[model samples]
Target: MELFADRAEAGALLAERLPDARDPVVLALPRGGVAVAVPVARRFGAPLDVLVTRKIGYPPQPELGVGAIAEGGEPVFDLALLHRLGLTPESVAGVVEEERRELARRVRAYRGERALPPLEGREVIVVDDGLATGGTARAALRAVAAAKPARVTLAVPVGARGTVEALRQEADEVVALLTPVDFRAVGQWYEHFEQLSDEDVLDLLGAA
Candidate 1:
């Protein structure tokens, strides 16, 4: 239906729809999520940070994500997909380990030794650019949940409706600007969905 011109436009629109935050902090899933989250953090006057997670993609077709793991969290998989693919967790162990390594590398590059902020009594809003399978978001939310936030919200610009609905189990609230029925890929909803480099994410974080 509707399309977002870019991640910034999506972020601005998403920020407009976000609820008032009482002592909140915005943690974005980089590198695209950083762009979508800058405005949201500005809207709430909250601190901005990055949360690194990586999707565990099918080995033969890396773009076909089967699961994900956040930097310090256990892997999460779509068991149904695994079954359909005639795969098992044990079979995909190598892929899981590889993604975990990449996740750690990203965490080191993004935040260094800095740990996640104290979220014990704050509203932690986890922002992402969009959701396809939502594997990464699921892992990210669970990681944040372990830190004992008073509430956790997963915010995205656009997403597949089914994935958006399924993510409700992971967060205290889920905020998606658009959940289109015909969602095939997240890039299809944007005209300028360019690949973001780590430097780009750093720049966004610095500006925020």
Candidate 2:
């Protein structure tokens, strides 16, 4: 069975399982996560903001994420992947720097002048459309943890069971609507998974 028809539908379903927080701050990973996060923030009556993160991929294999960097935080590398791929920080420095620029550009585009919402001692729900490798989510969770949130919950519409289980170590809680054994890609769970643009993200945030 298809778990969600679209990002908004997934957000609504997820909102039902999320608890009411005393001081809630909903952080979404753009540009797709914003759609899945809108209704979730509305459900909790909380402020929503972007938690920007960029994946650092190998020079030849761009699809393979070796590390990820989040705003105001250092790059978090997958040490095993680095070892397996025979890579090091020096080799990926250029990629990290490149993604840093893109990350900054996205932050500026999605949120022009508004400062990031206060995460200190607040219940933070990090929403993403889905988890594939857990690289980006790991970076985001660590970045939020550094900000000293009271609790960090990783919420997604669907994810690989292993990825969800592994992320539980970094997050205070993990809420996944579907952890199908046959999970291949996040888009597989959604009937419509179109790529979201910067304007799309802004529109969603504006509506929220």
Candidate 3:
């Protein structure tokens, strides 16, 4: 039961495990990843940026995520779950559109007019708090892969062992400090896993 005190502490630990790269860049999955990436960015002297990926939740229970959309990628859904719920992509069209708008808004607010930094031939490290189901991380990795970076690593403080293993296929490297087998929810591995506001994300980005 390794529990992190907070995102900053977790980020500090993760920073140590990251490998040195050639002209590195750190892109965080914003709202939460920004905090965790600040220290990593500092460690690598990498420019910190946001890669917005909004979750497409179940229509009735908005917290129950079924898919995610990354900044430069289409919505990725769990087909098995969709079938089980008797839903399809067309049925969730509205949800996808809503999340797309929100993702665009976040990208605008975070990056302004500046586009994603040069990723081709550079090591791109994507940081997030943790992986629950890994839908968001998968979408983000695919989006990053499209840019054809030299390499892309997905870094996290803690994750389910199975999820981390699954994400290894999506990333060149998947770094999780604590991949406990008993993992349930990501928050359970943290002592204080408060939801970060958009302002908090901006503050971290500015500070880094």
Model 2 ranges with Cα > 4 A deviation: none
lDDT of 3 at 181: 83
Compared with the true structure, what per-residue lDDT tens digits does model 2 show for residues 171-208?
99999989989989999898899999888998898999
lDDT of 3 at 89: 88
All models: lDDT? Answer: 0.92, 0.92, 0.92
Model 2 earns a TM-score of 0.97
TM-score of decoy 3: 0.97
For all predicted structures, in order, the TM-scores are: 0.96, 0.97, 0.97
Question: What stretches of model 1 exceed 4 Å from their correct place?
Answer: none
Model 1 C-alpha lDDT per residue in residues 1-208, reported as the tens digit of each score: 7789999999999999998889899999999999999999999999999989998998899989888888767888889999999999899999998887888788888888899788787899999999998999999999888888889999999999999999998899999988999999899999999999998998899999
Cα error, candidate 1, residue 30 (Å): 1.0
Which candidate number maximizes TM-score?
2
Candidate 3 residue-wise lDDT, 49-130, digit = tens: 9999999999999898889999998888888898899999899999999999999898989889889998888899999999
Model 2 alpha-carbon miss at residue 140, Å: 0.2
